[model samples]
Target: MSGTDRRYRHGLVLGKFYPPHAGHHHLVRSALARCERLTVLVCAASVESIPLADRVAWMREAHPEAEVVGAVDDHPVDLLDPAVWEAHMAVFRAAVPEAVDAVFTSESYGTELARRFGAAEVGVDPERTTYPVSGTAVRKDPVGSWTFLGPGVRAALTRRVVVLGAESTGTTTLSRALAAHYRTRGGIWSETGWVPEYGRTYSEERLAALRAVDPGADWTQVEFGSEEFPVIARRQDADEERAARDGSPVLFCDTDSFATTIWHERYLGAPSPEVAAVAARTARHLYLLTDHEGVPFEDDGLRDGPHLRPWMTGRFRAELERSGRRFLLVTGSPEERLRTAVAAVDGLLAEGWHFADPLPERR
Candidate 1:
């Protein structure tokens, strides 16, 4: 019989496999059906959040027929580096009994690996599966995207949402509610559990590093100079370039380098010509949350002063108007905050905003 007619002896699946979800299961099942033997190599050097053994167990439970293997430990290296590919290939060569007949991957690297190993490579189109998903997509909306995960995997993800906000706002209450909502929806809800006050996290080490840097360094002097102003102004231009290349929608950021420049001038008293130029180039869609009825001021550690609320709100609005950007003022109780945020997201979605990052294209 020809090679095509012969039963494939072995197949390999490689990935981080943080928690094997539906897409992963579909790929494994397809591979198992096509090959006499299957091996799964789970990358161990993922983020500190998930353990390697847990990832292996997740894959094993989902594909019991496959021989699941953990990747060999090596000094962490950046995957983007050209040299890393050869190093990774060495590891794979050592782990498998012999060069596998076929390699399975969702990434373009699968094709490259096939060329290198002299084996048939298959790029599985994950979108064709029962629940098409990706790790990055899963990370962006863990609670809402739980349906794509397996029963055991969904339970594990419940404990890992990160909610970030600035002082005196209802971030603490909101964070708790978000976690509770995830649980109520029958998924894992991971957060810090309580809002830890801001300064509690900022350490003296950062302060010392800032102080150690020379105020009159050549780079600093150049940044503050007129000739270098336009060069620094190109920071936003870079973001625009990225957006163009990826066909992603523009996000009107609440904070930008321009705001940082203003804060430096106002709080640090370090105004410069370059700072003005930087501020002038920033594009924004400022959404100033204003004081409203029933939104009582609470004594959170970061928001203790009585005058800061109105003063900061006024300043924020003034900055937006001065900068000549489209803005909207949102004011109301906690319920109103949620409504306003949801409405803004919906508006962006309706406008067909595409994310710059690699993700499933908006339907």
Candidate 2:
């Protein structure tokens, strides 16, 4: 039969997928090409840090056509022991009860797995050459294997750094500098991303639309509605997510959704529960609050908050502390701020991600 034609009536692909990488996706894709119907079993153990449901979701998202399911298989791996093998098979069978026509895998145990199911063994890439990556390698050094990871996994694992503070406090400058510095590393680091403040774009667009209607209209004539904060916050959050998914290990965002809540207060003179709710949707690792003391606020036509700088800075500090968000207050010249920000970001990265040890003896 031709490769495009389904050779198997049913097929199974199983793994811990402890944070699915490209290699896992390759195997699933290869299996789908050969089977009329396929099931991806994400068998996670109790000791794994990543939740079983998350693994199942990632696999499902990556291979939407396949039936993706999860099973907690805490039982230790002992392929040589018939009793242990039977225990695993029971879990596997319970999760995927239908008889398998073929078992597709890049693992050496595919032969035994297929034999137990009375199915044929189809090995996609027994060697690591096709995609030289594994769950162990990912867990050990995610930054090193960043490109091998898919967007969902990358978004989940990326270290998000937010540069937010009073206007004219060098948030944009520092954020751009951080992204550029990381790009100097070359390789995957060249993809280091920086998310622009969506609020600025919104403001520019609003002003332009207003000027189009009345040629004399300016920033003073611009108005912000309380309802608009949530929209900007959501858009900012989405932009950050997009950048994180495509960027390197670290993502630099100049003013994030959380900052939108503060700007809401600046414009509307009160807190906004709507914007705060939207801001809570995503996680940001570190906040660099730039102090407005030494820097002169330039009236860039879009900003009239120079007089409110101290209050804004104080308010940002209070909110960050009140909400128990991790942050660092930065001061001095642009050079000093960049140096301090880099040190803080490097420190955050030094504390590597912690992935709980999976059940002993992996396939």
After superposition, candidate 1 runs with Cα above 4 Å error = 1-6, 72-82, 126-130, 159-363
> What's the C-alpha lDDT at position 282 in model 1?
32
- lDDT per residue for candidate 1 within 1-363, as digits (tens), equals 665345578888887765567778787887887789999988755333567787788788778899998874453454455566678777777777576888877775677777767889876774556666777666565545556676455434322222222335554454444334333433222221222322222323334444569533331221222333234335533442332222212122223344344434433455556666665553433333334234566653323344545655565567667767554565567677656654553454344312223212211
Per-residue CA lDDT of model 2 for 176-196, tens digit only, reads: 999999999899989999999
Where is model 1 poorest over a 10-residue stretch in terms of lDDT? 244-253
Per-residue lDDT, model 1, residue 355, is 22
Residue 18's lDDT in candidate 1: 56
How much lDDT does each candidate structure score? 0.53, 0.92
TM-score for each predicted model, relative to the true structure: 0.42, 0.94
Cα deviation of 122, candidate 1, in Å: 1.7
- Model 2, runs deviating above 4 Å: 1-6
